[model samples]
Target: MFKPDGNYPLQLHGFLRDQNKIWTLSRENYEALKNVQTHTFDVEGNVVKVQFNPARMTSTSAKVDAASISTRRCFLCRENRPPEQNDFHLDEDFYVLVNPYPIFPEHFTIPLKEHLPQLIEGRIMELVRITSELTDEYVVFYNGPKCGASAPDHFHFQAGNKDFLPVFEKGGIKKEKSIWTKSLFSAEVSGIDDGLRKYILIESGSPESITAVFTHFDQAYRDFRDDDTEPLYNLVCARDGDNFRLLVLLREKHRPSYYFAEGLGQILLSPASVDVCGVCITPRQEDFYKVKEEIIKEIFNEVFISSDQLKKLEEII
Candidate 1:
């Protein structure tokens, strides 16, 4: 049942505990979270966390191509979902369920009820609303189809514990000031190129206005890329009081060259919204140990849009 006046975080905690009792896979994975190893690398003064989470191998190495997706059963589909996995109704269109393969201590996947392609063009407002409503306990994020989404065939959003990502930390986005700032409608838009990452930060007190500004920016970005499809990017949104902060991380490619490199050269790392935001996941233990500052720089440099691209995009928007 959906309770508008109830505490969402408390409700989610209850839901998670209930699921763990019935779902052995989810229970085991959540238990395994206790042993997940992590280390940090200082990248240009910003701390980037690298987590050795072997359970994430399924997501890190997912085959999202058209042919592969068509052949496999859609896991997000209601009929195909595991019988033990129950969900809370977020609204008429979506359901909130515990992610069996979790990255956060308390992770949740909110997928649309109808089977739909994972695209954010017309759904930015939905993201804004979800972020705002759940602001008290969680931060919402979206991984673009070609970016980090394992189930690109399904439209969904993910929520994790607030301040879990490094980007929300002191030296992350807070230290990286805006290169360009402008006000469109009732929203404040800023362009940030912090050497390692390029971002479009949008802040607004009103949801409608934020959506309008994002739409305008989206069209400008589409024109800049000259692509009919949605531009490559990942999004993170957090709300504080009446204000909402949305970070749009631009992308040049989905995976780094090392990901495709064979044998010893290979690093099975696939960065999405979470990785771009600062905590990168390496599903293989070897890759976790192999990653260094230079490697992190290389992977980040290869995937994120260049400084010149961000500048041009700023002008276009």
Candidate 2:
């Protein structure tokens, strides 16, 4: 159902597009989202309200008691072992499991077996190296913990048949460089663009190119982010003849639990089932455009762990 005026409540704004969800935010609501602020807005005749809740950063929504970790059945570690029916082994520490809700017929996940923290470092390099060696025609990617990884506790990566991600197929890679001499490149994705940040398309035909891209990004990661932190991100790399198309996403956060609780989240982000398989469900248009923004705010509020937990995560990272 479209908002009567095609606008969101003032407190909720911005759109989130995944394979199943695409949402638009009202300009007024988008403006209310400062680091710590609460605002209300009109939704049709009713006033639907939203707030930037920082309790997540200040408090623990649910305790991660000792039992949680030991009892944790990490799919990347347990169910993925020995390779499921639609899956195959990629390497010793990594395996390719078919995306249960495939956005494309041959979508797969290349997840690491260990319950390592999901961050770009030595582990990601290994994943990039392996994927490069395995095939020249696949798209390989990683969605950072705050970006799209629902299983933030497990370290894994994903891939899909080249045609699934239109953003990659449609754009061409362009080289870039930071002031510090770190080299990088990007391709533009049309549907979404944040003028302040440059989103680009990318591809890797050789391990060297993949390595270069990852290495450069890793360096940029180090350069752009605080030495003590990570900026949420997502990636897509495709092959185009002798070259490749890649999409690198530097994002702010993930969708909220409501997106997952309601299936419509998937329909809005049509074209990418990754979120469906990983987190929320999106079944239709309103869910995509309306609920996505509300949930994003919710996700931001919910996942902001306490300083103690953040410190622990930092120590491990």
Candidate 3:
């Protein structure tokens, strides 16, 4: 059902090149990336990269509310996709396509062939497997429906160059940095509260073990939140040799108050997997310039689950 010609990165290289030759919107957006401005702020030692990418205004300002979503066609659906856009089948159920609006140098949107809600309850293993297949070249991430996903009506995963997100870099989530650690289903699970963000990390060489632990944690989180819907969170998975490191960034809100603020106080920042990971994107140059260490800390504190909640989750899980 999918190409057997080359590995993912190789196939993606060709796919991107071919798409750029034909897809005007994608080509133009990518070309616009050359002028994107970026700066860094150190929030309690954690470096947060703030990018001024105007092309991302579409996604940054997207309305994923049920009412709003109902009125629009699903952009991820094969029939609804732009005519010039093309896809590389990953499997019978998924297709990999270059992201027209990008934050990473190499970015892709992998969508399920079938139209489905954005949920990750039983799909942790699929994410792990895809991360493994992509090897060390890319990191795969999932934005929970209410977390950061624009297409809340469709199921998908995004992949980007692994080096772009600082959470995977040194000084980010070492075992020693974890506030607490436990072993479940042969996987090592660590809970971290890095002053600004509260997240859970699961590490294991065995995909089965990782999947089992994730399932266990997912239920616990759902129960703790007392919500039927999937818990609000953003997940990042990267393959480390035979082991997979999954970072589940817990969330309390989708967008911070600054996002809805009026006039000069408004900041179009949205915290997603990539944003929470250290690279925050602002589609407006003014917002990017307005962001500072205090703002970063405040935004993170507002969106992420509180230390009390994380402690409770640690005990429950």
Candidate 4:
């Protein structure tokens, strides 16, 4: 479990305390987290929060183009990471480390041990497992390589305090409207239209069953997308009793048109998996103050899968 008797929380806080003393970047980010500005507004019944954290500019303004990515050293790689940062070996292939630029009060970045390209092709089940283990205190999340990952060159997942996400503030699947899709074996896949965002939640107790349903959904999404690569999407996973819930945020675009628009149209905002769940990030102070309900709605509209694309996914059922 992630926070067994809440020891992981203490251990991580200790790591952060130690890192801040020697790791300048980590210290700076921690300071930024303390002073980060935020504003919340109700949008279509969803109270979305916008944050201005200058430390996150690296991620928000990441140049994910192949050429640009190749030219830079992969920071997620062990040798490239700051020496003061501590990590716990999660498995033969992943390491759990505190995220220096944090979104939650206590945030973690779990990266693959091998330096691998970021892709969800075969890793979705791991997300479910991690979430199940940390059910009580934290939620595990994934950022699709093209959707929100700043370190797409290195496969990784992020974890954050569950209380911070607005999604947890809502009720469970039984209380929400959903379009239950055909699932694999005993597993279940259902699309929830939560007015704020379209979410596909996968539920199952068996890892094998969960993997089967997600693998099927992943393929269907790729086939439905126009590009020849993995489709754009954001994901989050948490546990519900003995079962795991995988929330998929189907995306069609990485950034809204306003990201590149001129004058008032431009907002230096980057929508990630967390953002899809109601906590949008604005690296610039001006952008954070300028955010309103209409702009928030527009971002969702641009990034979420179109109605036709979604219908094609339902056809998979």
Candidate 5:
């Protein structure tokens, strides 16, 4: 199903008539076709149609066996096979490829040539610099392996524009004064507030300010753990006129409970820890509706608090 090269299924041509255009389908038309069938088991030993595609998604257990391994042989990094021939190519130190299963029409990913996990190094700064200068309207983000990265073997980041995701369309922090605020979600768990009191911007519109901010945050993180590994870090920096707002998150020890809620009778359609907690791009209405709020809350619990760590967190909360 995945065709990293531009030569994807011919059916995709029907799905995407033109690559340049955004929001190709109207809301009504999009909603109508997004409906797909889901099957669930009933107590009476029969199958039931509990929810429609646009309603909720039936949770299924994730194949965590392969992902749990400490060591992985990354084909992307090793150049065993690259993304697509025409669509992407190797730059000086990175390989550029258009995301084959892009949520946004023209989504692209720039991955490191080596399989190093440490992104706080100078390499990330170079990537941000290149993207900011070349990308049309896209915003780039990094997902730490433990945070939400599906492919933890190779270090890579995601890029998409504001038109694709509703959450990034407008910004100024969700609220004017609250440390924790919510937007995009009608419910409370749609978003939760967590933060790093300090941040350093490595580069920005003004090279000088970028240098200052980067120095500040980097040193703080190093100081946080003189001998221990700091939590996996995720950060999003957006261009706003002459300045930028850098959103940074430090991964913690707790994993959420909703992650294990898969396969329940009811459709618990929440996205994984990455999509809900981090930047998730959903192209279809089905994904939005089917992804249940309860499921998302459970995922949050799992990401931040593992079963073993839950009791310990209870004492602090």
Candidate 6:
């Protein structure tokens, strides 16, 4: 039975108390959080924070090929979950659980009830609602399957403590470029094309308007990809007061060839949604120490749509 007067975060707190294993991992996270190495890089004037965390090696080094993924059992599914793991049911089809390998002060992984492929079709608003419910404290983000998701077979969204990302800390847009239209026929849109990174910020005080804008933007992105399915992108949605703010980062590729390069030149790093949006993750100690600003700029250039292509998409939108 669904608990009538319960909150998901509070429920997770209780579960952590009862589940010693998860509780211990959560405690370990506190220690890892302290040891995290931080470096600030200036990319042609825009700043990005680079973090070296040894604990993230699993995600950074994970092989996401179809055969590798198929050989392994799904971890997010209830039947495959750890015996000590517990979750708070958000509804009939989703559950909220503490992320053991956390990247934030407090993190969560919300997975669908059914086993499904990692596709974001028809689910943009759920990202809005989750961010709305966790407003002011958490930011809900979606990672495209080919972009960063290790479990690309399972549909999910990650919630992390707010203000940790450099994009949020930067506050309002800087050096705003006038490339994309600020209005999509009816709804309001803001474009931050400072050349540092192309961003399409959509805002609406009402969910209905927000939904329409997101749908329209998604359709534009799909058309740009020239396909009938999910396009490559990273989305971060946050709700404030009566307004919903959605930031879309368009992508062109998954990982650069440098990632697969031979030793000394090879830096074992994989740029994900989080990585692309200014908080690059370095899972290995050596790479973290050796990574440079020019390298960071190159990675962004490789993963993101070129300025020329971005302008083309803007014209199309």
For TM-score, candidate 2 versus 4, the one ahead is 4
Native-referenced Cα lDDT, model 2: 0.42
lDDT of each: 0.87, 0.42, 0.89, 0.78, 0.40, 0.75
For candidate 4, lDDT tens digit of each residue in 1-317? 33335455556567667767887877778777877788888876777889888778888889988899999999889898777887876656788887888888778899999998999888886887677665647888999888989988999999988778887776523325564465666877777665667777777777667778878877776665545687777888877677677788888789888898889768988789888877899888889888999989988888887655554566774
Q: How accurate is candidate 5 locally (lDDT)?
A: 0.40
Tens digits of per-residue lDDT for model 6, 1-317: 11235455566556544554556766686568777888998776666888887778888888888999999999889999877678767776678777777777667788988889888877886777777766656778888888788889999888876677776665434535647656764556766665567767777776566667878878887887788777777888876666777777777777877798997888878987678667788878788887888888888888777777766765656
Off by over 4 Å in 3: 1-5
Q: For candidate 6, what is the total of clashing residue pairs?
A: 0
TM-score of 6: 0.90
Error of 6 at 265 (Å): 0.9
Q: Residues 1-317, candidate 5, lDDT per residue (tens digit)? A: 11123332232333333332334233233344345333232211211122333311211222223455355445445455432322233345665554444444444566776777634555445534544543335566766555555565567776655344433444323433223322211111111232211112232355334434444444555554452343455655555444443445444532334333355433333332224323332333444355444443443444442333322222221
- For 1-317, candidate 3 gives per-residue lDDT tens digits of 11234587888888988999998888888888877788988787787899889888889999999999999999999999899889898877889999998888888999999999999988888898888878888999999999999999999999998988887888876566678899989999988888878999999988888889889999988888888889897999998777789989899999999999999999999889999999999998889889999999999999998888887777887
Candidate 2 accuracy as TM-score: 0.51
Return the clash pairs for model 6, or none.
none
* TM-scores for the candidates: 0.96, 0.51, 0.97, 0.90, 0.56, 0.90
Clashing pairs in 3: none
Q: How far is candidate 4 from the true structure (C-alpha RMSD, Å)?
A: 2.7
Query: What's the distance in Å from true for residue 217, model 1?
Result: 0.6
Stronger candidate by TM-score (1 vs 2): 1
Tens-digit lDDT string for candidate 2 (133-197): 43444567777665655456778787755443333333222233211122233322221222112
Off by over 4 Å in 4: 1-10, 172-175, 179-183, 226-228
Rank order (by lDDT, best first): 3, 1, 4, 6, 2, 5
lDDT of 3 at 100: 92
